[model samples]
Target: MKNFRREGNSNPVPAPSGGVVAGDGVLVGSLFGIAAIDAAEGESVEIASVGVFEMKKTSAQAWTVGAKVYWDGTNKVATTTASGNSLIGVAVGAAANPSATGLVRLNGVSI
Candidate 1:
């Protein structure tokens, strides 16, 4: 139940997703990914939101996530995603040219 509020915003409101039953009041984090890169090139490693305050490397492929996402749950049961990937860490990729940004979306809730 750790909520990271953006700078200047002290509300620390809970970001819950709608339509997805697997998520609720849980927690979430920003979804970021590289864009514009060719599929033939070596892609960035995949990322997954491990709970609400940590991220883990789960794949060796590229992935994307909403920018608004900013929360993750507190259970390791659902450590990584099935297929899609989510960046839940503070370290961005070090590729020569990464997407840099993606749609900002909330996490914890389904999206």
Candidate 2:
């Protein structure tokens, strides 16, 4: 374990412009995570890099169980559209179109 480091389930990163609220999905550089707490812009915030989270999704899009999901940073929602979006995780449960939220399992790795 000479090269061991802390487990990366969560990580501390500077909040992006406009800050972040608790439970907000965040993309810092290439890392994607959910904010563990509210933090001001440029302040350090602990982001959960792995685990299942109920998050906002594109209300017009329907999601099926096990479908890959991407993070739409600008709109701040989970989406099935791949182009221009960052891969965040997969849908763990079916989400009906027009629903406000969806269940997602974090992949713990950047796209």
Candidate 3:
């Protein structure tokens, strides 16, 4: 394990233009990630770019396993649309017209 570099669960990234609170989704550099905790101006906060999170769903849309999920930055919700959206990850499960939230597997990736 001498050459092993620790891959931490989160990364310290500067707060976005509007600042970020705990559990808020953010677009840092080329990475679409989420704030692990609350942070203020002049401070670095931890952002998690991986793992599953219960994200808000834009509209009452049905989602199926392996469906491509996108992060709607404006609405702060997860959707299946690709155009003008940040690709987050895939839907881990199915949701029939999900109203509030749904499970999304975040891979910190984009198309």
Candidate 4:
């Protein structure tokens, strides 16, 4: 227990350029998490690294339960496409096409 630290389900990380709003999904290095509150760029922001969250998804793409979800940082949305996206978690529920949000269980690790 000598090297123990606080539970990592949430941690403080610098906000990316352009800042982030509360509830926004952010990628710090290879870690993906949801912003716990609004923070300016370069400021330390608390991010929830693991949890079931209702996240923004590609409105045009439908999602099935258990499908791998990736974070499209550029678009600030959750996506099923793996190319150029960071693996964040899995879909916990089916999502219909044109839906703006989807339920996701954050895996906390980028891979």
Candidate 5:
């Protein structure tokens, strides 16, 4: 049976989805190279939404691989610097298989 659309019959608005897709994460790696951003704030960012934290290398530091991080961006506790990219992000994991039933950001325009 065809669903009914009452009202003035305007085009249906599309749902939000297909945000930044999380890649097969490293156990304890840096998120700095997670995704190169041309700019911050206005850019569309996505995380596990619920899982381990995704950490990114902030300074000239090298962290061990296979470690879980919450992609809290750089300088999370502090503000971003003009020279480096210290933007905060989210952490992701496999409790929800972001691939099988992966996570995605809704309302791309909203973000």
Candidate 6:
């Protein structure tokens, strides 16, 4: 048991363009998830794959619980529109209308 080590739930990765902040949605290769803390360019930081986060969303539309959500990397907003977007997670709360952000339950699933 001396060599045993606890595995972490998060992984460190390079930041994307413009750098990444805590609570920011980051997409690395086929892995799309959230930043656990603020990280500058080229810096290693923890990225959580599964958690409930208040993410940016298309404020113009409403959301329902359990509805599939996609991460619009270009706009950095979560939307119900699924055409050529990465699957981030599901909406745990409802967004009545266009607003600042919405709640998303990140399950760490790929598109």
Top candidate when judged by TM-score against the true structure: 4
Evaluation by TM-score, superior candidate among 4 and 6: 4
Q: Is candidate 5 or candidate 6 better by lDDT?
A: 6
Of candidate 5, the 10-residue stretch with the lowest lDDT total is 102-111
How many clashes in each candidate?
Answer: 22, 0, 0, 0, 16, 1
Which pairs clash in the backbone of model 2?
A: none
TM-scores for the candidates: 0.19, 0.96, 0.85, 0.97, 0.19, 0.86
What's the distance in Å from true for residue 78, model 2?
0.8
Worst 10 residues of 2 by lDDT: 102-111
- lDDT of the candidates, in the order given: 0.28, 0.94, 0.81, 0.95, 0.25, 0.83
Winning candidate number (lDDT): 4
Model 2 vs truth, CA RMSD: 0.8
The segments of candidate 2 whose C-alpha lies over 4 angstroms from its true place after superposition are: none
Candidate 4 lDDT at 32 equals: 87
TM-score of 6: 0.86
RMSD of each: 15.7, 0.8, 1.9, 0.8, 13.9, 2.2
Instruction: Kindly list the per-residue Cα lDDT of model 5 for residues 14-96, writing each as its tens digit.
Output: 11132222332211122222222222333443322222233323333223322222322223321113344222232232222
Model 4 over residues 5-111: C-alpha lDDT tens digits? 99899989999999999999989998889999999999999999899999999999999999999999889999999999999999999999989999999999787
Residue 66 in candidate 3, Cα distance off native in Å: 0.9
Off by over 4 Å in 5: 1-56, 73-111
Model 5: residue 7 alpha-carbon error in angstroms: 33
Indicate the residue-level lDDT of 31 in model 6: 74
Of 1 and 3, the candidate ahead on lDDT is 3
Winner on lDDT between 2 and 5 is: 2
Q: Score candidate 6 by lDDT.
A: 0.83
Looking at model 5, residue 45 earns an lDDT score of 38
